[model samples]
Target: MPCLARWLVLLTLLSHSAAQENVGIGLDLSVGVEGVLPSLARPANASRIFHGIVFDAGSTGTRIHVYTFIQKDPAELPLLEKETFQSVKPGLSAYADTPETAGETVRQLLRVAKKAVPHVEWERTPVVLRATAGLRLLPPKKAQALLDEVEVAFEESPFFVPDNSVHIMNGTDEGILAWVTVNFLTGQLQAKTKKTVGTLDLGGASTQITFLPKFKKTIESAPPDHIARFDLLSTTYELYTHSYLGNGIKAARLTALGALGAEGLERKVFESSCLSRKFREDWSFGGLTYKISGIPDGSTGFTECYKEMLKVVKGVIHQPPELQDSNTFYAFSYYFDIAVEAGLIDERRGGMVKVQDYSIRAKEVCNKLSMYLATKPFLCMDITYITCLLKDGFGFKDETILKLTQKVNNVETSWALGAIFDYFQNIKIH
Candidate 1:
């Protein structure tokens, strides 16, 4: 049988067994189950096969994820076949003044979805766009305008566009969704499983740390927003999650230079010890450009960079006491990028590194600043900031090991998949 026909036959079989039992189908990470809500239950005749399009409007870029899923039976969550992922540079927030242009980016990426899903299923495939910290940092009017333009473009598409499909996602949801994605893809969501890994996502404008806390005091001591409780399958998880805005690698560079919120970049020049004495560059972010360079008169190296980064991290990040204990964490995005570039992990296949390893590498890379600058001028600063962020900012002990990976089981480690799972739960298939 052909692919579509075979899938349809499988759906028929699964739908017939829909009433057997409830299995994990993901959950709204931001919302707690107040005694088992109806939305949590799988529909009696839920479709076994489906597709979803999720657009991650991150600070540095916009990425499209087209997912194909199949439920083995109604009692279990849908299994992802594969993800068609593509990204474009200069995120939606970059088009603050040209909102329409941001919409065009989404329109262009939708082509990937068009080619991936079957033509007959186009109208049933739900498409959504979730903007992250980039949009959240923009002016209210500008952010709304960008979202509005994207909604218009989504409406023009043949795929099904749900209400409020394009909007800025809250920080808490961002952290929670990412946690769900990592745990689910890692098979930690299986029933009666206590082993779960923490997730550390280092984006361009913000970073998030999320994990299921083993200690009750961890939850009680955490700020209300940092603690998210939700049920999946038959188990309830209280996750210690928080997104630190303006702490991302790129943003940290700005912070280290003391240029994050400075207005009128025309006359002001920001300097930092993180850069080499001869280094100078004009970097742009969040619709603003600034002239930044190294402090010509001051010293530059791992020691100097660490001191500069300390000002950006110390006392700013809430260090959960439980984090100091040994635990497995999967770090991705810029974390994976820097680890691979710094020779801490393999480029194709990721490896493990400890918090102390970053410090050791940062010192080694910084001491030989000339060689490191030849390959990547910012390596000194990037490595130093990462070390501080892991050790001082998040309060991870030097011995804490982190798994640096770009993908888990071939699926990219991101919140897009988890968001899709949540999307299907709230939508009614007519």
Candidate 2:
């Protein structure tokens, strides 16, 4: 089929773009959604380039990814040439009460996109914001309020705003897209032997695990929701993927302290064995405030902390039996950040580490709290939780090797890059 003809048919099904409302368009690529992004073919001497602006509305922060792609060959996938990235702290969910402020945050990030993308191309570029666990965990009304404000911001921008461009993203798509990002950048997608690695993303409010299962029993024994079948570039992938809500690092902290969803947090104090006995502080997450402290005179160490962390993971995360065998995985986001802090990986280059490395580091951090009190009060709890999540939650063996990294092939290893492919397939580049 001609490239123009393929996009015309896709645009018809995506006609909701004209409504300009905050609708949740499920890009369940699992159903083999075809390309909708325009293709431009020119003389061999001329080069065609296009841009995409994606806002990752995560729990801890909001980041803008301005991606520039060049179509060197009409017969091949576009090459990702460059990415201009910027971020702002305190995600949209923090402004749940004052929704207008959430809109302003997006507007602030738009300036980065404005500079990153050429002015002449502004009218043709498609801009979107996909809120993750942060907004998803918020109350329905509050989440909608934030999305409404963001939509208003997009409307005021110079860029093209597609229909349902601003909305909360489901976890299933989050995991699968992230997997696509890692595999795509590593050149695994085009290889003859499709030996792609799994992905593990630990955010502030949720964590996701996704991988292509090699054995038939892996898919058969899995829950129906855990299996996602999607086609990309004419290749079908049956992946085992799942995102654990309220199981992110920050949310897990509250659960370990017995503060998650607790009523009257203002009047009560939540204490945990995970922290030093002398530790006391106020923690804020998902727009709620809670006073948390450690036991005044109770024993504290890896043993006590591990017990608390285990409470949040045990029986909560489904352990795929196939994962017990050796398999490669690219762990990022919090996984990369914490690993760097624990000295298990290099801060710049990143490196490989076994699942047991986290446990060993967690024990060291927890056993010697005083050494890290000023700079890392929660390092003990945070690291221990990661250790528990991998072993007890996901059932990874101690010898399981994980490649921890912030980027692959110079592209930030994130679902944003994988997600932009859909927008590229849907929008007209001209």
Candidate 3:
């Protein structure tokens, strides 16, 4: 083979090996189940069968998800972290009876997938299975046996460990290219069009936004990832993505009441939920800043600090180009204001939730703003908001946003680099 071809082969092999090490899941896969992220760097240029099958033995039902990645352009079209999920009802679904049933489910899903994408080389692809919060809830022996049966049924590997990357708490938010905030921002500018579509992605644990232009494709991966991009309707665009950790519903409630402190505090998390331990320190999201103020030392452990974060993020909410009406900024601002009047809001005692509440009282603010702020990171809320924002906030209009995005793309000023510099300043790295 030619040198270039040989080099490509070598890289793929290396990447595959890396995949073996990186096979961890994340919070968005399910609630109450801790997720392990993949150690493998997201594929950038090759097409492969990257499948994730999840089994959550829950009180409600068993949930399962099967996703495949056609890595023709791994960097451009990675199977999203979003696609890695599905639910199963053990009593209702045949797959719940025995390992045999689970295997059958896999076979059935594969069959359907084959029909959808005939080019898939299923025989060579590897399938992976991991259980959620329920896994540990069951006796260890039982969990292991079930996992073993699942491994056998699906002809896949199973993992029982939870490795939360970034911070040691509130896990989730691994390698999705959103952490390189500056690059993510610059990439957005490059993807500018006539108008801007704000995406508010509210996940089980985190939230993010991706402003896309006309020439946008669904970006599935970020390789070498100095920067990140977004994909919409198979169109890819560089975007300014902002992510907030511990911003999900459960956490919202937990933090609201000052339950989850910095230490020994699980936050409003279900054991199987990936957000519990991942969100706190997940710096991998570029252009995304994860801030919470529930810490005791006015830090990431208490609700008071989180109230301040509400203040800090007001800048983003009130940014140029027409801020979203339903954004949390106003709610937080109003909540804080109320607390001040009632003398119940104290930044020192986690008593500012009132101030945080009223600031975002716009009737359709959160609902409408989701049109353009949605990214896959924020889970269910993200979907609702993004869908709502697109329909309501922008009134389902993309022409103006697309054109504006294109204009931003044309004006390249290295925002990402500047962001990095700003990051350094914040940290006093000099």
For residues 275-392, could you state the per-residue lDDT of candidate 3 as single tens digits? 1223333211111223422122222211222242343233222122333232211111112222333334453332313212322322223223233222322222222232232333
**Top candidate, metric lDDT:** 2
| Candidate 2, backbone clash total | 5
lDDT of 3: 0.30
Worst 10 residues of 2 by lDDT: 18-27
TM-score order of candidates, best first? Answer: 2, 1, 3
RMSD of 1: 7.7
Selected candidate, larger TM-score, 1 vs 2? 2
Report residue 191 deviation for candidate 2 (angstroms).
Answer: 2.5
- Which one wins on TM-score? 2
Clashing pairs in 1: none
> How many residue pairs clash (N, CA or C atoms closer than 3 angstroms) in each of the candidate models, in the order given?
0, 5, 123
Per-candidate Cα lDDT values, in order, are 0.80, 0.84, 0.30
Which regions of candidate 2 fall more than 4 Å away from where they truly are?
1-44, 426-430
- TM-scores for every candidate against the unseen true structure: 0.87, 0.90, 0.30
lDDT of 1 by residue, 279-368 (tens): 778889988898988788888788988999998889888888899898789999999999888999998999999989989999988877
